[model samples]
Target: MTRLMDQEQENLWDSVQILSQINAEKAKAVFKVTIEKSLQQLGITVPVFSTIRLSVPSTDRLSQLRQIEKKMREAYAHQEKEKAYEYLVDYIERLSQMTEDDPLVVRKKLLASLLNERYKRKPKWSAKRYRLSASLSPLLSKQVAAAYYTTSEVAKKLGLSDQTIRRMCEKGKFPGAYKTDGGHWRIPRKIFITTPEQDERAEEALQQIDIKNQKAGYVDEFDL
Candidate 1:
């Protein structure tokens, strides 16, 4: 399997280079064959190919196609083979509609939205509120006003690691995290617990600080 993967990578790399040099029809042929061979090498069946209708030959179009390829590589790089293979097929089909005028920015947003839809566990209203606020500012009518923080922030407050927080999200234990446009996870503040132990700890710390300050007559310097 390792050897097959190596060969597939080589083929894909060679095909990418060749795609830039060849005519559109030839490039398409090479790409299709490479995809097919790669799928076969992995003991997977290739789905029906989607034909890209290129209206123009330009660097911008080439770049979009390449971006699609990059997305495919990134998606499959660490995923289960069966799932990765399936996603790649869908990605290639989407790539076929490349036009020089089609905005890469919009394309990327569309791709992210699609990918998120595919893997999303469920709608998280609280996470949605934070994300919508950050992106749209004024807030969409659909957004609920819920306090959201990142996993890191939540982890710090809860005395947990970001990984543990993420596991909570996956398990539907955490209320929900909104993945920001920039891909940062946002946790709803409403879901956070300020336990009695936390309050006790905070109070203890304040008491210690107060005691130290009193000996030095630093009462004016302290707020608590």
Candidate 2:
């Protein structure tokens, strides 16, 4: 009977040790993931420290993109539409060269679409602008085009005057509202007139994009 009890005690101790080891391993994995995510947010990738080596190249590309986007925003703030458009063209050209299957390419394409929309109603819309917008259209999904509403379109939709819509947008009544270089307001359709089904679809789309982005070794959190 004493031998039997000793054997049972040994088995219990072994199980306890196994459980403790598993918990420790899990904690280490969680810590590594947390560190990796924090570094990614800062646009830093240390391949030697991370198991996700594939992310290093993409992260470098994203850093380059962020610099270009910064220049574009600066140009926009200074009311230099032409300069901003030039930067946008450069940005899209770089994204086009990346593999189409890349999730980053899709996200960047949507951003490029938004930037392209800003110049659509330019008073001095040039042939160059038209060509650039046209070339970029094929690269973007139709959903991106459907996501924004022009000031006049919103006015018509809400049965309000265009001036009223612009005033509301400027007063922060509209979420995701942005002014174009031509001083026109563009509103996000999702925030303005989306039905529950539309909202669900949009959420699902974003979740799918997130999943694909994760598989691609990065998460997209940057905006123009």
Estimate TM-scores for all models: 0.29, 0.29
Badly placed stretches (over 4 Å) of model 1 are 1-4, 7-11, 38-47, 50-90, 99-224
lDDT of 1 by residue, 27-112 (tens): 44444444433433232322222222233335565555555445555445556556665655555455545433354543454455
- Clash pairs, model 2 backbone: none
Per-residue accuracy of model 2 over 1-224 as CA lDDT, tens digit each: 22342343333223223222334332223223333222222222232232111121243554565467556655665788788768766654554443334545554544544444433453554323322233466655254446667878765443346887787777766645666445667666544323334334433443444465467643333110
What clash count does candidate 1 reach? 3
What's the CA error at residue 206 for candidate 2, in Å? 13
Candidate 1 residue pairs that clash:
52-96, 147-189, 149-187
lDDT of each: 0.47, 0.44
